[model samples]
Structure formats: C-alpha cells, structure tokens
Target: MGYGKRALGGVSALALLAWAGAVHAQDEVTQVEELTVTARRQTENLQDVPAAVSAFGANSLYEDQVETVGDLQSHVPNLSLHVGDASNAVVYIRGVGQIDSISFNDPGVGVYLDDVYMGRVQGSFLDVIDPQQIEVLRGPRGTLYGRNTIGGALKFTSARPTNEVEGYLDATLGNYDDRRFKAVLGGPIASDVLLGKVAFAASRRDGYTKNLLTGEDDGDKDTIAGRISLLFRPTSDFSAYLTLDASRNSPDASRTPHRETPIYSVNTGALRPVIADPDVVEATYNDLEKLKTRGAALTLQYDRGPFTFKSITAYREMEYRTHLDLDSSPDESFGIYDFEDQDQTSQELQVLYKGERLSAVAGLFYFKENDETFAGLVGPDFFVILPGPTYFPFPANTSGLRLAENTSAAAYAQLDYKLTDRASVTVGARYTYEEKWTDNRGEWFDPAVAPSAEDMERLFRTGAGFNVTGFEAEEDWSSFTPKVAFNYQLSDDVLTYVSASKGFKSGGFNGRNTAAAQSFDPETQWSYEAGLKTELAERRVRLNLAAFYQDYKNLQLSRFAADPATGNFVAVFDNAGRANMYGLETELTAVVTPKFRIEANGAYLHSEYDEYIDGGVDISDQRHLVNAPKWSGRLSASYDLDLGDAGELTFTGGVSYRSKTYLTVSSSEVLAQDGYALLDASVVWSQPGGPWSVVVSGRNLTDERYREHAFDLTDSPGVQLGYYGAPRTYSVNVRYRF
Candidate 1:
C-alpha cells in the first residue's frame, strides 16, 4: 500500500478505537495521581482545579526527547504551532489564535518563563533549557494572566540551584552531521548563606534540504545558550535569587518552492518556463538570520508561618536581523529581499501572597520596540529588456521605520472557601489598565543615484509628512477581566470540575495605511469548560478528559490589497469578525504490565466564524480558518528489559498524526496534505553502579515529505508554496551523571 493509504488506514483504526468503547474501557482501569498546579491562587491538585490544564515534568520531557517548546504540541491535545516569516510563531489552542505577524504586539496565547512575561512573539521560540516543569493552561486566563490570553497560557519553570553539589554533562552526534553539547553545575556557596549554578549548551546541524536551482544546502541551524544564577538566604524568614541568561542563533533558510507542474504529469501545459537571467536567479535568493537575546531576573521571597510573600522583577532584550530571497522561482533576481534590523526590550514586576485558602497576585509590565527595514526588488536594467532603455533601473527601493511602546498595570485576587474536605468553590477577579503608542515612517527611493544633501532632506521630510497623516497619531487603552471556578471530588481517585473565564488582546494602530485610517478594538473571549480526572487499577493507569466551548467577539482581521494609485500592496488591521469554537481533548496512560507502558492522546476541534465581513461582503459561517486543523493526536509505547549484570536497556517508539487542513479563511482550495504518521524509536543502556550511559534515537524513519505550512497568492491560480516538515534523522549520545 502507498504511504498515504497506510497513514489513512492507521487514522481510521485509531478513530475506531476511540468510538468502539475501547478508550472508555481503558480509562476505567487507569489509576490517576494527584497533580499540584498554581492555576488557582493557592496550590491545588490539577484534578481538583476547574480549569482545563495539562502539566509535564522533567522526566516526561526527557523520555519524549523534547528539544523545544514547539515539540510540546505532539504531547498535548488541542494544541499546535504555526510557522511564519522572521521566526514569528503563532500558538493555537482549541482552534483559537492570532494571525498577525507584527512583533511589537501581543498574541492570542500568552507565554511566561519563571513568572516573567515575554511580550514579543518572535522571542518566544527560544530554546528551552533545564526546565523543572511546564504547564499548559487552556481557556481564558484573564483573572491572573491578564492580556493576550484569549486561548490560554504556557508557563515554564526552570530548575534552581540546590544546597547539595551536583553537575552533569551530555554530548551527542547524529546523522546528517548533527552534533550537540550541554553542561550544568550547581552547589551551595556558603552553607545557608548563598548558592549558585551555571548551564551552557551548543548545537549544530547540517542542511537537510538541497536547493534544486543552486545545488546549495538549506535548512542549516546553529544555536548556543548560557545561564548563571545565584540564590541567597539571609534568614529563615526571607530569601532572594538572581539569574542572567544569553542566547545566540544562526540559521539557514527553510523555505521551499511550489511545484510548477503536477507531480503525476509532465506535459500537462501547467509548468511555467524557467527564467534564464543570473540576476533574477540571484535575486530569487536565500540568505541567513542571526538573532541574540539577553535577560535578567530577580526574585524575593519571605515566609511568616501562616503567609508567604513573593516579588519578582525582570528585564529582557532581543535583537533579530535577516537577509532573505523571497522568490523561490528558479529565476532568483526578481524576488530578493532583506531585513536590516528589528529589536525589542521589556521590563516587568510581579508580587503575590499565598495563604491556606486565599491568594492574590499583582504586576506591572512595560515594553518598547524599534524596527528599521530596507527592501528592494531587483531585476534587469530597462535596456536589457527593451530597446533604448537607457539609465532605467529595474529595482525598486522601499524602506520603513517603526517605534512602539506598551505599558500596563494589573491586580487580581482569589478566595477559596472549603465547604467540605472534598469540595471547594473559588471566586476570582482581575482589573487591568493599559496604554500603547506607535510611530511609523516609510519612504520609496531610487537607489541608483546618490541624491544631493538637499534632496535627501526633502525625501525625509516628505516621509515624515506621510507618517503624520497616515498613522493613528495617538496611544492609550484600558480593560478589566474576571474568572470563577468550582471543584468536586467523587472519591480518592476521581475528580470533576467546571470553570468560566474572560480573556483579552490589546488593540493596536495599523502600520500600513495607504487606505483610510482604520482603528482596531481589543478582541475578547468568554470560555466555558468541564473536565474529569480518574485513576483505576492499583494506580497503574490514568485518564484525563475535557470539553470546552468559547465565544469570541470583535476578532481582529488583517486584509492586504493592491493600491491602484501607488501599485503597492497595503495591509490594514480591523475588527471584522466573530467566531465560536468547541473541542474535546483526552489523554490516557497505562502500565499494562510491570515492564511495559503505553500512552495515547488526541484532540478534536470544531470552529466557525459566525460573522465575517470583508470588503463590505459577508464571508461569515466559514467551515475552516487559515492554518487551523480539525484533528491531531499521538500514540507511543515503551518497554524495559533486564540485561543481568550489565544493568538494563529501555526501548521506546511512537507515531504522531495530523489531519488535512486548509491554508486560507475562504477555504476555496485545500492544501490536502494527506495525513502523515512519523515513526520514531530510541534506546538507552546504562550500568547499575556506574555514572555512565549511552542513548541512540531516530525520527521519521520513513522520511515522508509533508508540508508544514501552505498558502496561495491572491492573484495567482494554483500557484502555492509552503514550508516542508523535517526529514528522517538520527542521533547518538553519551552522558555522565557526575
């Protein structure tokens, strides 16, 4: 059978298992455990909390070989990551996510590292290092998280230095010339006086894709990161900690070209003739990106027997620049482009208090960013194309500069009154005030000539004039969000709960304004969720299931159109739509036998735009939104075998699958990536008494070709390009505990 057929068959089989009461039977015999989470003001078991949440610890991440936050989508139901230009990633939960690419604004999903907010979307894709735990809280987290959490929040907690001295190093090498190295050390500095730790990691990978036009390597990647932390305990009542980190990334292009002809037919009159100009080929370009990020955080804690107080302050800065060839056609000269610079800085502070049954958290946040961009469309001189084309330049030069600032302050409190030992009702509310400002300037110039000083001044002044007339020319906004939840335990091994919450995304000015000035309103969402957690059969099995529905209003939509007068495309942001989403997520883990274990997780989503108006036409009630998928899931199994005196060997394998999805809101044409399942396997061997071990892993054993992202141009017919998923790869590593 073909790969597509096999994948479809597997999906059908899984669907049958889901519907034939097999999953229900498995849940009955699973034994769930108590999971502590801070989704509420006070610590409570995840099963007892009314909100929909998924939590993963260090051991689980290690077993899954997760290298980045993007990898979490496979393990968590109803979640996916969207890839876009300039390292801009959009995270979606239950079919709700923002589609804009501007970096200075907020995203539909919020991400927090050690309680410090990361305001920009581009920087959120940084590598994860030495994390103690990660929590994905689904639905509106308005009461505590505040803005830009219309979908949910991702919280990462890093491992801290301990009183005991400990350290470890890991090294790996794999197929396609991939190599990785990492080291970590931590210990007490002076008994209870101080503690410190340091961590460093580096990775390199050979290009996986071969450029058909240039025969050059693409998809290459390199990353390096380091962190230092210090903890001080002055007295039994108070303590403080400080941490600093830095990271650098240099990566090659990952863009793929659209096929000019159908793969099944050669002479179907569909293929466009390849351009023969070297300049065009060069302009069709591929380039590189270099990004650096630095951050520092300070945290203080105090305990007074019955109450605990904590305060955290943090600062972060990120710089990113890229040079890209936008046109993937064989003719390179026509589609070349470059991004000179983009940067952002943020500062935040948070304070909180916790007690037996009551807790409160408050914070202040500020962010600022400045971006300068230069781009040119290169082609042949006029004379090369037509007769008497003297001194006619084919390249068009365009440049833009933008400055943005955002500031906000918020306070929230939650009170839990235990009516009984097994039942509790929590009431929470949050209030937030915010302000935003932006300034943009743009100019179109003829780069061939060196304009006189006076001419340069004139051009700059004209650009400023355009900014005065086009931009929003002001800054400020305010909002308030609230939340409530209830929990009930049926027994020691089973719990059920429900919750309702509100979420918001801040409004921002439109950067492109060739058309009339348009103002956007903050998008809001109200979510309702219910879930059940159960454990059975001597604590050997666990099952978690949740269903949620959300109603969204004033959804921000971006529209791009060509200006007949300037012949340039203009983009504007407007609140032109509303949507509703409903979904089910289920996870199960079973230790069927002493030496064997299996896990199965899946998500099913249904979303629709109830009201959508574009260009004064109703395009509402669409079946699918761009970059949204209806079904995705993962399944895996592992076993441990005793090797006698040599110790033990552990083997693991898994497969992940995603169903077909559309690439546009209109859903006029389907990307139709026939569902694909990637096969992965790994093995680890270790000695009983030694501090040494070895591991080998392989992914995508079948090397399936699939599209990660896809889109078609508005003016072109059947002309589409997309980013392809990774190919087959393998890695081997040796590690030492001390």
Candidate 2:
C-alpha cells in the first residue's frame, strides 16, 4: 500500500475522538494534570517556567515505548537523533549540533544523568531504567547548564531511594527471538537513617536484516545494564545521595552498509561494477563492536532557614573497540580498526536562597578529562585491480594515535527579582576557563615496499603511519556568557515571557590530521526567544507556544572524504564564518472527556549560512545545514475503558512525520533523506487495585523504509553508502508490582 494511505490511518485514530465526545456530556470534562520541573536549577510549576521545555513522566514514557534516548526524538518537536555507530549517536535540537565523533571533539547538546553532566557522547545512547522524569530544553542554556549547550540540554531524573519498600519486575517477548528482563527494588537499609535502591536490565534480540551470503542477520542487539543508589539522612537538615551505574554491549551482529549503485572509480576513471546484489545484505566481511561504560556520583545537601547548600562529585569512564569492512566485498580494499578510551572527573558547589521578593543561585564548577585513541586502516596499494583470474594483494597500511587532556573551571550566578505582584525579571552570567593539550602521531608503511622488515612489528608499533609525522600542542580559552529574562502573568491561567541568552563551545585541535596538528576556533551563539503558556476551555485544554531566533559566528564544521593515496577515509575540520536560524514551536493537549485525551505538537525551522569560504573560495550557496528538517510534528490519541471488576484497558496510537533532511554539509542529493512517517500503537490491560498488568505494542506498523544516516564519498574513492532505520517490530510485556 502507498504511504499516503497509511498516513490516513493515523488520521482515522483522531477521528475516533470526535465520536467519543458525542457519547459524553459537557459536565464530564476532565482537567489536565499539573507538572513540576527543575529547568532553572529550582523546583517550579511547568506553567510558571519562562522558557521552552518539554517533559515526559514515567507513565508517558511507558505509553510511548521509549526504550532508549534515541526514541525521544519522535515525541519532541525539532529534535533529531542519528546513530553513527553502535556506541555513539549524534543529537540535534532546533538546527544546531556537532556531526563528527572523536576523542577530542565535544558534543553541542549536553546530557545530564541525575544532575551530573556526561562528558563523552560515546555512551549517551543509554537505556532508560526506572526514570522518574525526562526534560528537553530548547534554545541556549548558557547561564544554568554550563558550556557546550549551544543547541540545548537533556535532563534524565531517575527514581530516588525512599524509606518505603516497593519494587517491580517486568518481562517481555517479541519477534526475531527478542527477549528482555528488568527488576527494580527500593527499601530502607538502616531504619530511618538510610535507604537504598537497585535496578538491573538485560535484553537480546536477533538481527532483522538478512545476510544473503552467510544466511545470517546483520542488526542484532545484546546488552546488560544495572544501577544502585543509596540515601543517607544524618540530621533533619542534612542529606547525602550516592549513585553508581554500569553497562556493557557486545553485539555479534553489526551494520552492513548498503552500497549505492552507479559509483565510479577514482583510479581508472571508470565505473566500478556492482560486485553483489544491491537489494539484500550481501557483505562478505563480518564486523565487530564492543562498548563498556561506568559512572559514580555523590551529592550532599544542607538546608538552613531559607538557604540550601549543595555539593556534587562524579567520575565516569568509557571504552570502545570496533572493526569495520568498508568495501563490502571479498577483496580487502578498505578496512578500519579503532580503539578509544575516555574518562572524566567533575566537582560542583552551589548555594540557593529564597526570599519574599528575591531568589538566587550561585555555584562553582570544575572538570577534568583524559582520552586516547588508536586508529588503523588497511587497503590496496595501487588503488586498482585487474579483472579475471588475477588475485590482487593488499599492501598499503596506515595508523595513528591521539592523546588529549583537558581541564575546566567556571563560576556562575543567577538572580530573580519580583518588581510587582505579577511581574519578575531574571539576570545571570557565567565565566569559564579551559586548558587543553594534545599529542598526535601517524605513520604509513607498505610491507613489500617500506624499510620496515617485519609487518607485524609495524602494525603493533605505537604512533607509526602517515609518513611518520608527530606533533604536540597546548592551548587555553576563556568565555563569559550571560542571560536576561522578563516574565509577567496576564491572568491566573495565562503567562508570557521573553529572554535573551549567549552560549559558546570550546575549540580543540583535530585528532586525525596526518600533517601538522590543525586547530579550529570556538563557536558562539546569541539567541532571542518569546514564549506563551496558557490554559483554555475552562482548564480542559493546555497550549504552549514559542518562537526563537539565533545568530552564530565561527561555526565549526567537519567533513569526511576518501584519500586516493591510501584508499582510506580522512576527516577534516574548519570554521564556517556565520549563520542564522529561526524556528516556531507549539504543543497542545486536550482532555475531551473523562476517559479520552488528544495531544499534538509541531515545529517549523529555517536555517541558512551567511558566509562560508573554503580554500579561498566561497561555498556558502551550495552548503546546507546537517540534521535540520524544515518541518516536523506528531499527533496522538488515547482512550480508557473500564470493565468494572474485570479491570481496565487503555488504547494508544500515534504518528510522527519529518520533512526532507540533509545528512552532510555539501547538500548532495545522494545523501539526503526524503520525507517519511512512522506509526506506533499499544494496548494495555490492568487489574484494578492489583499488582499485575500486560501490554502489547507495535512500532513502525506501516513498514516504512527510511535512511537514518548516509556517507557520500562519490568524488574521491567513488563509494556512496546508506544506513537504514529499523523495520516493523512488535512485542508483549508483563509486569508485577509489590
């Protein structure tokens, strides 16, 4: 069936809500639930916050089937997530984000786990476990969220330990031999003085993409994760919380790149004929990937009168290894092996005060990070192979090692003052200083042609291959960011606010450069935003709207291209001169009746580069911003059916849509993703006042095929690759509570 017809099915779900309204009376209208959030480092009502924020509670998360952080993009407007590898994924909010993933590069969007910042993006694709709430803040959070928040921030708040004993166990079964198990428990450890909580999860699934050659799958998953939390209360005014988490993913199946046809060779200036069928997964080489992550954090707080003192300390580590076959053919034309290790430590101190007409927060922060990486590539020496019975031997090899260390210190303060009964103003600023040091080296060798007598010794040597070049460099940077906002209450049910903010990302040396260690300048943004939060229809409907405009300078950009000499891909970094971004977002929720609900949200964005010069030539007109879709939206509906003593049944269904998206800066038609839509539905049955429940869910019911990411190398090595999104899947879950 056509996709247009499938989309109409989603519209039919919303039409059902109209029929439900006819059966219910006007007096049966239900009120929307109130939400509380910590967007500005303080607890406040969601309607009272003077910014653009979207939040999902525990119940909402479950209904949406949010298994991992990547799933959140479907429900949030103007947000995108692209999986580049097994261990890492790139996140974009509005139209700003980083594209390259390496040891030295930082993420544009910041992610926090229980108020602790995560330093590396490698482990950001975490599994959601017993989460209490998740919040996505749009625009630049310069004052309260620290550095690298030019795009926005994502906050994950997990359920804390309580004095009461409570827990749940869940099991799931699905197609493709999918199996999952999860357990969570919380109770008092030592009377009223201590409390603890523990959670563990294990999941495995067979791959869905069939390999025509090996008769096996190529996209399987296997993972295990656990978390532990402890809370201590020594006095009425003092408390401490400690948390530890660990996860490991070692999947046997890996992604098989789908080769785009009609690719030409750079060596002989001729078309490279397709070696295998382009329809199915026919890669001749097997790929491997392993990732491990660990983290620990401690928070201490003391309350006295109208002030609260807080301290937080955290440490985290991650290790990843991968082997990839780039050519997708039996001929070892291009292969990649990479190893990465990263660790970080951080400390933060804060003081908060609340008064009759004035409220304020002040804090100091420190962070240190160390990381090392080893990358090697093997390919053909001559970059060409004759036809027939000739067997070409691979002789070219290149390797590199990169080591970097960074230290950062910052101080920030924000204050909110009320000038009248319904009017207030907020002002805040932060100053950050950072120092970075890097050591990079590379070597190139051909066993039969180079001086290296032993091929094994050359492969094992540290810092050996792009002509044996090495460099060491150190640099420091400082920035001061600030924000101001004015808020006013139009009535008891309406609020309006306007704000201006500035944010910046630190600069760093490129870790993959074969010659001199090249450096890129920092990027900065100035943003202006206006928002309105309102409750209408006698408190039965809620609507929120926001508009934003951002001006950016020294925009950092990364590009990957194949090198004909070694037949390997190389990444290069540079600064785009200027850019502008503007967007509009709106969210609406309506409780039509006591047992029916409908929700809708959408975003419209426009982005363009003001100036871009590469190799002393202007290229601004040909480049497009990556991960920026012109339009995105979602629509959903849910209904409840009460069966008296039997129990209750809830039904939910939704569809998410995205316009055309560019995967690279060049705006190449071969790497752009067309408009697409996905449909999901779920049904749940629960026993009233009981501890048992069952849920049946289906995702991508329309079976739409979409591209999540793509790599364009048609000019140099003449290879274009595409990575597809997941196919249709279904599962059934059972849960027991105590």
Candidate 3:
C-alpha cells in the first residue's frame, strides 16, 4: 500500500477507537475536565462557544513539549506553521494563507500576544514562557479582530500577577548540546492593592546541519526572553494591568538549504554536480541570525452596575538581520543579506455589558506602524556569448531599500441575545479604514563593475548605493465585515451552532520587487460553518465536530518570478480569481479510567481553484493550495501508575500524520512534502502535590526525514533547495513547583 493509504488506515483506526470509547463512556462516571476560553472576548466553556477553537493550558503545553509557537501545528487540525528561515514563520489555516514574509506583505492568520496584535511574521514564532493559556480560533475572525484575520487567529496569554505566591523552575538537558533554564514567580507586592509577576527563559542548542566549508554547525538555537507583569487595584470596581516583555535571539544561520538538482549554467551550457547529502552544506557565507523584539501594554478597566469600560494601549518594536545562501554551494552563486526594523502603536477602547438575557461588547481601535528594510542579493554571472557575437550583459545582482507607513482605524460591536430557554442568536460587524504609503528604490548591478566590499556593506546597511528610484505610491482601502450565528441546546450535555462570517486580508505593494510599485487587491472570504459539541456520562467523554464551506475570492499568491526590467528572480505578489474550500474536523477526549486518558483529532480538507488566470493563461485546474494537505490527524494517550510511598509514574505517547503538501503556490513536485508521520513519547515521575518532578522525553522517535520548507529555483538557477525538519532527539527535564 502507498504511504497515504497507510496513514489514512491508521487514522481511521484511531477514530474508531475514540468512537468506541465514547459509546462505553455512556456507562462511566469519571469526568473529563472542562476547558474555558476567551475566544469571543468573554470567558465561556469551550464546548459552548459557537466557533471552533483549540485551547491548551500550561500542563498541556508542558506535556506536548511546546516550547515555541511552531510546535502547535502538530496538534491542530488543518493548520500549518512552516518556519522558512530563522524568523519567518508562514502560517496557514484551512488552505488559506500567504507564502511571503516581506515587511509590506500582510498575513492571513493574525497572531496576538496578550491583547496586542503582532504586525509582522518576522517575530511571530514566539517562545512559550510562563504561559497561562493559548487559544487557536479557526476560520475568519474579522468581527472582533478587524485586520488581517481572514483565515484565523492565535492568542497567547501569559500568567498574571496574583495575591498568593506561586512559581516554578525547570532545567533541561538534551542531545545536540541542548541546554535550557526557565523560572517564573508571582506574588503580592502590597497587600491586595498591588501584585507582580516575572518570568525568564534561556535556551541554547547546537545545529543539526553541518557546514562543510566553515566546519560549523548550522540550524542552531540560542535565545533569552523575559517578561514582567504588574497589577494595581485600588478599589473593587477599578483595576489596572501593565505588561512588558522582551526577547533576543542570536543563533548561527539555521536555514541551510540542500540542493536537489545539479546547477545548470546558462553561460557554459553544462551541469555542475553538487554533493548529494541532506545533512551537509558547502557555503562560504555563514553569519549569525540576530533578532530582537520588545513590547509593552497597559490595560485599565472600570465596572459600574452591569457595564464595564476598558482601554488597552500597546507599543511594539522588532529588529532582524540575517544572511542566507540560496544556492547552498561553496561559491556565492545566489545569496541574500537583509536588515529590517519595524515599530507600531495601537489603542483600543471597549465597553462590555452583561445582563440576564443579553450580552454585548463594542470596541474602537486605532493602529499605526512604520517599517524599513535594506536588502542585497548576489547572483551568478549573467553575461552570455552567442554564436559569432560578443558577450551581452544581464545584470542579476541587486540592492534595494523599502520604507512603508501604515495607519488603520476600526469600529466593531457584537451582541448575543437569548430568544428562548434553549436558543440564542449572535450578530456582529466591523468597519475598517486603512491607508498605506511606500517608497521603493533599487538598482541592478552589472557583474563587470562589481562594487567593493565596503560599498556593498554600506548599501546593505543604508540602502544608498542604488542608482534608480522605483516608485512612490499611496493607497487606501475600506472594508465592512459581518457575522451571524445561531446556537441551540439540544440536550443538557449537547450544543449545536451554525454561523456565517466574512473576512478580508489587507493588500500591499511588493516589497522585494524594485522594477515597479505593484499592488494587489485584498483577499476576501465568506465561510459557512456548522458544529456539534457533546459530552456523555457526566462528561467522561467529549466530542466536537465541525464542517465548513468557504467561498474565497481574490486569493493572494506569492512567488519568485523574473523581474521585468532586469530578468532577476525576485519575490512577487498577485491575486488569483477565485477558489472553494470545504473541510470536516473532529476532536475527541475520553477519560476511560481514573489513571488513563486518550485524545484524538482529525481533519479532512478539499480545495480547488474555480477560476485562476496567470499571465493570460487559465491554469486553475493545474494549481493547488500551498501548505495544505488532504488529511491530517493526531492521536495521543497517557497513563499513570500509583506508587505507594514514592511518587506516581506517568507514560505518554503520541503520533501525528499529514498527507502530501505543497509548499509553494506553483505546486512544484520539488517543493512538495510527501505523506509522513511523527512519533513522540515521554515518561514522568512525580509525587502527589509535591514540588519535585523528573521527565524523560523523546521526539521523532522513528527518525523520520521530512522537509518543512522548499524553494523551487530550478527554472531560474537550475537548482532546487529544501530545508529538512529536525531528526530524532531526547531530553531530560527537572522541575520544581510551589
């Protein structure tokens, strides 16, 4: 049987087991714990929410070893998070996302820290430090999250200051020289009036890939992060919260690409073979990837009667610099260096009302941002000699700078009204106005007149060597998104909901292209969904299922295409006409015994372009969505054995599978990842209500080889490149909790 068939059969068996467990749960008395979420701007039971949401608490995160945001995709249905480079994380949900990570381009899925939105993907792959909860809201979230949430949204909430002292300390040692330390503490500062919390984490690891030229390790990890939170309450109805967080990442370049094909020289008309190895690369340029991110947020709230007024203000900044070898060769056939700086400020005012039969939330928001980037690229010699003709110059090397400024304002409101004892309806809408201004300047360099090292470094730092100004343009856009939902209680333990919503991702100029300032229209989506949530036998078993259909228009796509003026491969963005997507998702959790538990989730997705036109050619039938797979699932279990005097021992195991996936919009075979599965296991020993614990964990136990990101440059440079995932590894962790 094929890999796809085998994966499907395994997932089917797991689903069957979950179903059987649900049936048996009808006679059991043990209960599964309930999860609370704030997906709709209000705290409520996860099963009672009208939308599809995945929530993970601190314990769950630790059990799954979710150290970073990228670790979340394996547990979610129809979700993909690909870390293409050191800091660029391409995120997709339900077959909707953007592939590019330029500063000007917007993301389909929004990432939020606390209540503040992260403006760029350059730092969206945040480390999980002292986390309270993390929530993934699937589908469009335009009603509450007004900008760039056409696909979905992710929310990370940290632990807050409390009146009582609480904290934990953990140290970990693993293979590949992995070392990690983390500490978190929270306590009262002044009786019940002031409270404070602080968290710190430091992690370092050696790279998995080896650089043959420099004898250095690539794909490494080194980072330090800290966060502080304070809460001041002078009265029972008024409160203030302040949060500050910062992180610094300095690691050896980890995006070491391996060549999939030999280099085809356009000038020599011959192929140059490369070393055929996935774990080794020959690159002369090896630089440290440096990224720094910091943010601050302040929230104030006042309550009167049944109405509460709140205000949130925040500021965030990020700086990133990196050098990458695109050709993965000893010589600098194709390389790139980038320096980016960005900052943003936002303000939000909200009023919430809670009543016997009606609940409502209304908000006004404003955001402003400034971003600048300087980039340089080195390409192979582009001069060619024809029969009985002199050589002609074809400049492919380029240096450029782009500066962008954006501002937005929005007004939103959502209300839920109870019609009968078992029925409720929700209505919400948001209106947003946005404007953007951009300055693009760049010039192609002739190989015959190569610049000096000092000049090249100056251009990379200040973007001053460019001789041509591409364009300066300003654009404004407005959108009105709305949502409606109906929820019904079928039984004491069953809830059903149907919803329809519209969302849009903002449009922008091509930040990498210097020939012209081009703009694409905003991509929009209208989704209709139905969901069922059930609990049986005193909540011993919980099952949630959802089905959705989406009408996607003006789908945004990004690819490396030839520049019209210089014939150089540069990142470009455009829009496809239309597409349709439909999918089914199911999640089950059963507490079969007091010490045994099982969790299973699966997704089935089907997507097709209804109308796609590329350069006057109709190719909708030949194209597929990027980073989307037909089937994805995960099954995990845990069991605990009691020890009389010592502690309890727990054993946990999990397996996750994904079908074939295309990483680029072109759906090139060289950029596709085949069906694959990953296995993980862990053993933990702890005393009941004790402070000490030990955990031994192993990931990718089978040593599976897979590609997380791939670039198809064969058409331009005659070589394809791929970035492989991590191999098998194990770690030992010691923890102390108070």
Better of 1 and 2 by TM-score: 2
Number of clashing residue pairs in every model?
Answer: 16, 6, 0
Q: Give the clash total for candidate 3.
A: 0
Best by TM-score: 3
Q: Which 10 consecutive positions of candidate 2 have the poorest summed lDDT?
A: 1-10
lDDT of 2 at 545: 83
lDDT of each: 0.64, 0.78, 0.81
Candidate 3 segments whose C-alpha is farther than 4 A from its true place: 1-29, 265-270, 380-396, 445-454, 457-467, 563-567
Q: On residues 391-414, what C-alpha lDDT tens digit does candidate 3 reach at each position?
A: 334445677778999998999999
lDDT of 2 by residue, 1-738 (tens): 000001111123234344444555557777677778999888988899999988888767765657888887877778887566445768888888887667678888888999888877888877888898888888888788877888899899989988899999989999889999899999999997899999999999987677666788876788999999999998999999999999988888666666665443334445555534433565544467788999999999999998999999999999987766555544445556567899999999999998999999999999999998876665543253333312234356666778889988999999999989899999999998988999987777764443322342345454333468779999989989999999999998889999999988899998889579799888899999999998766666677788999998888888766544544456778898999999888777767677777777788889889999877887888888888888888887778899889898888888899999988766778768899988889888888779888889998899887777666655434566666777788999998988
**Strongest candidate by lDDT:** 3
- lDDT, candidate 2, at 49: 91
Over the stretch 1-738, how does candidate 1's per-residue lDDT look in tens digits? 000000111133234334333333444433333456766545667666666777777656654556778767777787777455556666778776665556534688888877777776767774667777788888888877776888888888778899988877888899878888889899899996799999898988866666666666665778899899899998988889898988887877544444422211112322344332211221235565667778888888877766667767777777766544443454322332334344445554445555555455555555555554333333221101122211222344344445555666666666666668788777777677667766665554454431221232345535332322325355567677777777788898788888788888878777554223355888889988888876555555566778888898987765444343433334556876788888887776665554566667777878888888876887785536654567888887767788998877878888988777655444545344666777888887777677777778888889877765554433222234445666788888887867
Determine which window of 10 residues in candidate 3 has minimal summed lDDT: 1-10
